[model samples]
Target: MSGLAEILHDNGFKVQGSDASENANVQRLKKKGIEIFYGHGKAYVDHAFRVVVSSAIPDDNPELVAAKELGLRIMHRSEILAEILKQHHGIAIAGTHGKTTTTSLAFTVLDYAQKGAGVINGGVLYSLGTNIKASSKPGGFMVAEADESDGSFTNIHPKIAVVTNMDAEHMEHYKNLDNLRQAYENFVMNTPADTGVVVCGIDHHEVAALAGRVSDRKVVTYGLLPEAHISADNIMQKGAAMGFDVLIEGKRYAGFRINMPGRHNVLNALAAIAVGIECGVDLETIKKGLMSFKGVGRRFIRIGDAYGAMVIDDYAHHPVEIESTIKGTKGGFANNKVVAVIQPHRFTRLNDLMDEFAACAMDADEVIVTPVYSAGEKPIPNVNREELAKRMRANRIQNVHVVKDPEEFNSLVQTLVTNGDIILCMGAGNINTWGQFIVQQSKLKS
Candidate 1:
């Protein structure tokens, strides 16, 4: 939400916000003339401006309670963002995965294609050099990553909606995967009739159902397979990058290259292509847009090289995400041993999908599990990393260990990582801290 604050501040809206931690984002916001509070404070709430809170924050937040007690207007972050988009045509990228990259891609394409556009993303986009950007065009576009973690996508009504793919996730919030799918369907259906909805054909059935429901919106499908409206064909791998020809309507239109790791990224590129093509951008413009993307900070981003080892930090917290990320790494470095330092994301996710997590990490040559990042959730019995490591060992997976801190993780990597070894620090938590520590130490020793 730092991006939102920055954007508002730039637009002459007095912006003040609070965070639980004073991380890089907080620091950046402070530099951008935003008054940032490090902790919750009732004093932060005042009668001068509106208060915005994300879905992750509870209704019981002291600031929110104070705002309510003062009878001040309050808005969910998503709701306020939707209001901000009113002055510009909006494209909301929604999905369980790939939203960050795709949304970043869309904004980059618009900017590079010389069409003025604004952007908001969940992750720090290297292209914009910030999480948000302001544009100055009468036909300006607002491109945003529509998050569905707390069903926030429902609050956004974009002129264009891109559903990368819907996977069964955020089970704690949604009753089931079906409920999650239905929520996406409602999001699509709620769009204006003249708008377009681009659905990734990988999740053809789930997203196609949305197309069936939204008769007013134009629906287009894209994927790696030929069955979609836009398909990626003749895929070739070179290191951590993939080069493929994007086919539109069974005809190959143009060649595309994505330096980002993973087959899932091929799908993300296709989504960007679809959006660009619909917006009347040239094929070369789209290709350049994709090529210029250095990738968002944590989506398979290489932190730095540590000794002879290559360390990558990724925000893959789900089982499927873990498998995809590992597979992508293997595709890039075929002969290198994969050492994974995995910090299970949440207690509830660990308890719910323990077996799947084990299966995903089993692909690594060596796996080290760290204490779960609770994210404020209470721990469940027998659902810790030790139990996960034991299960992986019992499953005949070799070289699995449980670690408590970054020091232990660095020590494990020092022992296991050989020349040309690929070390992946995987999680949605502070696992990147360990990766960064290892890389920094390696740099210092060298």
Candidate 2:
């Protein structure tokens, strides 16, 4: 929503918003000259032409209620994004994971290739230091990270659609995996038939199936599979960096390197490369753009050093994301012990995928489970950190501990970390604070 405010303000719209509290994004919008209130109320909506609300905003929000009483037009964030797509060549990145990084990479590639692309991402782009970048050139492309959690991604009609991968996410909304797959199928099918191109990661069955159903549009498959139109070969990890050769149509297009760690990121880069090539970007420029990408904030971002150990923070809440992040960290730091500090994001997710989460943490040498971050949801019965730790131990995970308090978790992390170790704090909630706290504590100790 902050990105939307920035975009609107940049386009000469008077925007004012109110959040429950001030955060980094609110401060950013304030710097951009957008009026942002500290709390929600009806007064903030009195002078507004329209009201925009995110998925998290409740129906009873004071501003929302007042807007309806005033008969003001209310719009979902996706509606505004869809309208933005109509003005520019749109490339919407949709998937259960890796969408932000992939969208950021694609935006960077287009921007560097002089395509004049704008971006609206979920996380801050490390290179740009902001989530939204207005297109500098007229009639250029807009790269957007499409959220599939609410099935509203179908509202977008993009020139090119990239699905990094699909998984059983937001089951609370979809009810089952098949329902979620149908949503993705609809998102892909909603693309422009004559000009749309679907770039998908064939490694994921759901995404591969969605690609197969796109008969009227161009479909580009990418991954480690031999049948992929764009595939990576000879992947090598050097510490926190990875190098790989991009193969297009079974031939080497370019050898590229990225500062991010993981094969999933290589797939993400492949998606960006495919999009760039589809949009007439040169192979050399695409390689350069990807190589220059520092990575999105909180996606395995190295926060600081804790007793010579690297403290990394990531937004990995789903089991698949957690497993991929841990494996990627292990691959990058092969010799270093990977200590995972995890805080489950929601009670419903923890209750639904307890076993998968347990298995996801098995790769880490030591696992520290924290209390679940409710994210506004009511707590579930018998779903807590101790039970999760017990499940991990049942899965043959040797060292598992629970730290219910955030302050105590920081102290535990200080004692558990050592030189050459990598403390990977993973979750969607405030677990990144653990990484930051450990770094600050390390600085104090030093």
**CA lDDT of each prediction against the hidden true structure:** 0.82, 0.88
In model 1, which regions exceed 4 Å deviation? 444-446
Model 2 pairs in collision: none
Best by TM-score: 2
TM-score for candidate 1, please give it: 0.96
Q: Write the per-residue lDDT of candidate 1 for residues 220-326, one digit (tens) a residue.
A: 88876567788887887788899988887776765689888778888888888888877778989889988888778788888888878999999989888898888
C-alpha root-mean-square deviation, each candidate: 1.6, 1.1
What number of clashing residue pairs does each candidate have, in the order they appear? Answer: 0, 0
Candidate 1: worst-modelled 10 consecutive residues by lDDT: 195-204
Judging by lDDT against the true structure, name the best candidate: 2
Candidate 2, residue 352: the lDDT equals 92
> Candidate 1 — which pairs collide?
none
